[model samples]
Target: MPDELHRIAAIRDPFEQLRQATARITAAQEEVTELARLRRRVIEGLKDQGLSYADIAQQAGLSRGRIHQIRQQGPRPEGAFFGVGSVTIATPLKREAIRARPVVAVEDVAGAQRLGDLARSLRLEPTFETIPVGGQIDLNRPNLVVICGPRISTAVAETLAQDQRFQFERAEDGPWTLVDRESGQVYRSGQDETAPRNWDVAYLGRLPRPDRNGSVVIFTGIHPQGSLGVVQLLCNNLAEVYSATNGEDFSVLVGTEYDPDSQEPLSVEILTPYHLLGDLS
Candidate 1:
């Protein structure tokens, strides 16, 4: 029995070691809490600067919820505000109209109405044309022409790219940014190099509506190239358009062509009068 006990003594007591490790872990946890407290101050400052939760989380290598929790807490540690993340905001580029001439936009009825509303909203008047072949409108003419189709044909996009009037660059992997001939600024949105599909609303950078003269010209298309969720959220919040409708509109356009034969009736209840008059005034 004594020899057996001596053999067992050779092995260390793992349970005792585990207790020490646990105590060390508790100390480390306390240190982590201290660090988190310190981080809270800097996070509060960032929140005040319009930095989003996701942006802050990415920079901090922590979860957004954790940063939000830190922000929700009132007070922070003394040295917490020292380390901060980058503070850069993406400012959207603006372009001016090239020529004060009649503009043409190719789109469906719903798109037409929305574009019309946008024109009325901006006070910029332009011609809406359906025929693509007529030389009545010069394709090469440097005017504020807002294209509101579901999707622009690849052929047209290629042609537009060849035109020297607009400096076109494939902005990111999807959207093409086009700078108007008159305005050096660039406007960005995704372009579908395929068939025309669903209609959506957008502000053509160049066209300043006459009524809303000198203001941005917003137009609608059957299908627009962008993250639907972002656009839908904007519509829901600003236009008072329901998210479900936006979702339905987006889903119908996904992986298929949108039917232009029928126009969806927009509920007047969804329309929110956004006054850009103050800006123009």
Candidate 2:
């Protein structure tokens, strides 16, 4: 901190000094926000371990009142599963049937909006973006969540290809499916059946970003219902899901049995075990 201040002080131009100071403050603001979240989590975690506020305060050199306040404040730590401070949700634009113009699917919009609401509840800012019709997208961004399928987005497909454990592709038999490499089990959406049922399978994972600085959260399925069902799963099992991965880069196939009329998931199940990325063992 002193070194940065000294650097700012050494600046000859006052305007440049002011600009550097401003940039430093902006960077500090993000750090401060993250630190507060960490403080709150630790304070509450101690309480869960049966430590009294006074006990924690004594150990941490803080007052009991401060401990109480910290426990109730700051962003929810579990929200970090989706992102840190802000998350940009990127859905794909599908071409209109007749007009052949790019358009966002209604179900995708609902899923994106619902996820946005979930992000807000976690005290994270949410914004929306759309992958264009040809599937070209820049996957090098911080805190990005993509809700597009591999068939629609080649970029997403390429990202998924980095995972060696499973593959999403169509077999000669017909339907596009998520195939488990080790077990060789094929997971196809029930909607693909001859006697179509009200079920779908979705893929959810935290994939490595192209830049490799961090990762991006991705969820997609054979159909839009798969994505929608996964969103509901997220809304209900966020904490559990976050605990399962701990924000690691991994992938899982989700099976969802939903209502035929409303397309609401009645049951959601994790089909395959989590295939953790960067785990050679």
> What are the per-residue Cα lDDT tens digits for candidate 1 across 1-281?
56534444454787765665576566565466556655665786687699999999999899998888876662333211111111111111112257544334222333444534443332233344442422222233322333332133332333333324334555565654444444455544323435433433232122223333332222232233222222233323422222233211111111112233533322112112221222222
Model 2: per-residue Cα lDDT over 46-74, one tens digit each: 88799999999999999999888887777
TM-score of every candidate relative to the true structure: 0.23, 0.86
Q: Highest TM-score: which candidate? A: 2
Minimum summed lDDT over a 10-residue window in model 2 is located at 272-281
Question: In angstroms, what RMSD does candidate 1 have relative to the true structure?
Answer: 24.0
Task: Give the poorly placed runs of model 2, Cα more than 4 Å off.
Answer: 1-29, 44-54, 279-281
